[model samples]
Target: MSIFKSRVNTNSDTYNKNHADSLAAIETLRSLEQRAVTTSNKRRPVFEKRGQIPPHERLSRLLDPGLPFLQLHSLANYLVEDDNPETSIPGANLICGIGFIKGVRCMIWVDDSGIRAGSMTKTTMPTIISLQEIARRQKLPLVHLVESAGADLTTFLVESWAGSGGMFKNLARLSAAGIPTMVVLHGPSTAGGAYMPGMSDYVIGVKENGLAALAGAALVKAATGEVADERQLGGTEMHSTTSGLVEYLAEDDTHGLEIARDIVGRLNWNTRAKPPKRRPFDPPLYDPDELIGVVPKDYKASFDTREVIARLVDGSDFEEFKPRYGAATVCVQTSVMGYPCAMIGNNGPIDPQGATKAAQFFQLCDSANLPIIFLHNTTGYMVGTEYEQAGMIKHGAKMIQAVSNIRVPKISLYISASYGAGNYGMCGYAYEPDFLFSWPNSTSQVMGGEQASKTMGQIITAAAERRGEPVDQELIMREEKRIYDYFTKQESAFYTSGRVLDHGVIDPRDSRNVIGFALETCLEGRNRDLQPNAFGVSRM
Candidate 1:
């Protein structure tokens, strides 16, 4: 493999400016995450008083120490519930991520019951569905720390109710697909939420706090004139002894988490196949801290994407694929954390040659069974007469086709801008990459705000000129600003992340660890054998 030579000037004014800007953006992300943590932490006293562990603490205890946990959608419901942003909470009242449990990689979903008693918000269902999709595709075992109080009836909508069935459907699919679903009912899992533990392959319930009933006392009294205490109806003792809904019963939160971990350890999940051979790998020559300076805060400003690759891949060693042919679209074959992979990044727009090069590279990785990582930062495909005449459309289509049909694991990270069909060509979320994440400064849209404004303005002005009508300059300027503002707001990483455009916004420094984990997950799925059934295991 060829070692990638560095040409970046770390001391230059441009690099300093980019670094400062990136730091600010990263700070914004950090603050938002801190806010969510602070919001959840405030309820710890209450949870402790009730003899329950906080959601985050439960996750910490369950996961293997020192292992990387890639948290998803940390800011899921930001500024959505009310006009006053101060009162609105993020994270959809849930804490979900992928982490190692007893040396087995698994998806952990914890209900942030400390916050608002873990009421289900509008964003909750979609977040759970996204987690399920990841678990299914990546073949990761799923562990749910259930403590939700079910849906908030006051804000309920027919659409949410109709969509809620998808949660249970995915759970069933997971079982049939041979992915184990382990759930611990730390608190109430009533109404439709009762199915969370019922559909799981392994269920652990805490003694007095655990409850899984279709109808609680209030609901039963109102629906059938039957009165019963919640614990008597569906507590740990009742489920474990009477109904057999719960496979194990624990005395408290710590015991319950220990039981869940023991279940994962006993599954023999990792012994299904021989583990991949470990290879000695060198760390990148460049300091990962410099990653803050690599991606410019201003999306319009150009920077070398290789500076990014230099800090991420092992030993800064990268064998360029078609370097001279498609210079703008950089395709390099490199290893990440000792795992062989392909890295595709953009120096600028995707020209005809770039598209063809990327498509061919995709096929090459597929042939070699190497996972592909996308570092997205393109304005999009090039346009205009000369490029169009050169068959840009057809070439871009070929790139998209390769991305859609690739058999190997694909991961994407939005380093800066991901616009237009470039997003599709680079394996955006719509393409359903095995893992999709974004940097704090990343933005996504059909096009840049200024580009959208100018394009619309040109079209409107042209029509006015053709009609021999006087153009209202003020109105046109106002219209352009409106379009620009709209795109600018929606293109933010936070906004896109809140809307579930990607998996989550990650700190750039965590790129290598996250990518490594994701690649391992995909590899496990590819290697493991599953005993599939036409239908999933049922309660009966």
Candidate 2:
């Protein structure tokens, strides 16, 4: 009976030990599962949700399908304050990467205004810096889609006090590097948030939806005692006309996006992978006799020079760039006799303050490897205190710089009214145009007839006052006419005497043949991209 009791106790002890071990193993698994659930809820990856795809998917759908996206700073993430948690909004507000549009790759950043007004915090800086580094290394295009209230107030103190650098330096570096950056102003982007767009290569504003500035209207009113609405503060029409800050105004967001694509298509670096194919065009011949009818005998009489350009270039070939920006000058890309050529001409009626856009157009031509043909008829750089205030000196210098750097052929045709800086700026011999030709009545001088009349009128009036006698009107008129005739006749000889100033004077009837032959010879062995290299690398 004793031996049977011991055996039963041993069996029970063994059973109890095995049961406890099984319970512990089950509890450990349950603990791991609970921890996993907690982490899954806290850290949400950017995968698609149950009912919706993300903004990136929508963007891809909007652009070309089957295009691959190369994400920049994909691992770096945004930080959300506890007060502005995900429950209060959609999530941490940032969508950033480098992607392709129609197979052309670019860096893109989209702000989510749905969450925390798309404010920039310390956390967002890392992503921007990463994108900047990539842009510098690869020389890819950068595009910023802005929709922000401003920087986050919660993190502003930390940023100002801590060891942190702003994004302005990086943006300026990229711009100077010629990386071809673009900004899309979609919604309100105020203060530091808008500065990135302002500093970009091209700033695009969507009509009513876009707004950008250093401060909001309310803040501006408080700071400077100025009362204005949001549009007056930072609107497309206001900046496009008044400030000259924004470039390429769009009707809406969709249009703004499309403009971004077109601007990229027009850039030199953006299409470095392949050369642009030349399309066929037929430019009408401009008879030398026709030139006589175009310019009136009087210098003051104005005629539409744009019509002359249209008649000379190929059918509807003129694609005017920055037309509204520079009214005093016209810069257009078109084909003359089915060959690509850039035409720069003088157009009157530009605001005396805004003449420097002409120089910007010249710089763009140089960068794009396009040759120039100057049609000379400019009064001079627009004169006024407003022009001085607008930094016209600095801007006008850029034209001289660009013309000097031009390696391709440039031809100058002096029609009328080429004087002062205008004469030098419009591919004059000082700036070294490859060929300088002129019409029969071409006048290249420092000033014009009316200017001579005014100076002589002042002199006559002053002499009469000194003698205590009445002014002699007939004498003044005769003196003015003599001065005008002397200068006009002398200036016309710039092309005739074979001086350093003139290449040759050509008849209007032979104008077409002259240009056609000149272009054919000048354009030979051009386009450095097609040349053979021992190492098979492009040098241009």
Candidate 3:
């Protein structure tokens, strides 16, 4: 492997400006995240009055200390209920991530019941379903911390309710795939939600607080003349004694989580070999913190994408593939966290040569069965008549096809712009990257706001000319700004991430470690053997 030399001037005026811009953008991201945390924490007093700890407290108790937890979609459904970021809560009212439990990697799915009793939002179902898919794909045993009031009826969508059958069905699927599914009932899992505990392979419930019933006590009383309390209907004791829904009943919530840890400890998962042995390597030569300044704040400004790859790869060493042939498209053979992998990145728009180059590189990586990391920062595939004639369409299609078919794990990271067909070719949200994440300052849009607005202005101005009338330049400018705002609002990493577009928005410096964790998970998932049976672990 060739060592990559650094070209970025750390103290240059341009670099300093980039650094300031990156910090502001990251601060904005942190502020939004803190809003969600504060909003949830407000319910602390309420929980304390009831003698129950908050949901996150339970999560922290469940996971092993000091081990990494890969939190996904921390900002799911941002600005959905309200445009005012100060007042609205995002994150699907769910704490979903991957973490180690007793040294065994497992999916951590905790309901943020602190927020309106963990009511479902518009994006809640899809976010959860997607996470469940991730868990299934990675073979991570799923452990749910259940406490919910079902759907938020005020913001209810009938389609969401109808589609929720998949949530229950997924538990069964997870079990059938020989992936263990467990749940700790922290509160009510009533109505159709009752199946959450019913379908799990293992279940722990807290007495006096936990309940899982086809109909909650109040619902049962309303439907029938016979009245019953929740304790008699679906309390942990009742299920442990008669219904067989809960295998373990605990004295309280903390004890329930303790039982869960013990259950994971007994799985004997550590005995199996997962990922390949780590290769020897040194840390990257440059500071990873320089990632903030590596990409210019202006989306259109050009920067060497390798400046980024240099900060991320092992020992700052990598071998560039087809360097001079399609200089715009960068493909490098490198490793993250001492695990060998390939990196395909964009320095500019993809031309025919760039597209073909990427396709060939994808083939090479696939043949070697090495994981591929896609670094996105492109306005799009180059356009114009000359490029069209050179077969940009077909060549771009070939690259997309290669990405789709690669059996090796694919991870997509948006370092900057991810626009138009370039997004598709780089394994954007739709292509099913094993894991996808973006920087706070990055964008995911069809095109840049300025370009989109200018094009709209041109179309409007052209129509006025055809009508034998003059268009007002001021009006056109206002129209342009309107279009610009619309596109920009939807494209921010915060906006798209809230809609379940990316796994999460991350600090640029943490890119190496975040991608390292993902690579490790993917490699282990790919190699772990599963014992498939006809049906999942259903209660006898």
Native-referenced Cα lDDT, model 3: 0.90
Ranked candidates (lDDT, high to low): 3, 1, 2
| 2 against 3, candidate with superior TM-score | 3
Residue 509's C-alpha lDDT in candidate 2?
41
- Could you report the Cα RMSD, in angstroms, for every candidate shown? 1.6, 32.9, 1.4
lDDT of 1 by residue, 1-540 (tens): 687788878899888987898888788788888787888899989888879999989999999999878898887876666424455667889899989999998999999987878998878888899999999987889999999888899999989989999999999999998889989999999999999998888899998899999998999999999888778888888999999998889999999999999989998988885565446799999987888877888888998899899899999999998889979999999998888899999998999999999999999999998899999999999999999999999999999999999999999999999999999999998999998999989999999999989887887899899999988788789889999998888898887787677888888988888888888778877788777787787764
- Each model's lDDT: 0.89, 0.59, 0.90
TM-score of 3: 0.97
Model 3 lDDT tens row, 1-540: 699999999999889998999999889888877777788889999878767779889899999999999989888988876777677777889988999999999999999988888878888898889889999999899999999999877778889889999998999898899888999998889887789999899999888889999988778888996689878899889999998899999888889999999999998766664556689889999999999988887888999999999999999999999999889999999998889999989988999999999999999999999899999999899999999999999999999999889899999999899999999999999999999998988998999898999999999999999998999799899999999999989988888988889999999999999989999998888778887688888796
What's the CA error at residue 11 for candidate 3, in Å? 0.8
Among residues 3 or more apart in sequence or in different chains, the pairs in candidate 1 whose N, CA or C atoms overlap within 3 Å are none
Give the 10-residue window scoring lowest on summed lDDT in candidate 3. 268-277
- Model 3: residues with Cα > 4 Å off, grouped in runs: 465-475
- Candidate 1 vs candidate 3: the TM-score winner is 3
Ranking by TM-score: 3, 1, 2
Best by TM-score: 3
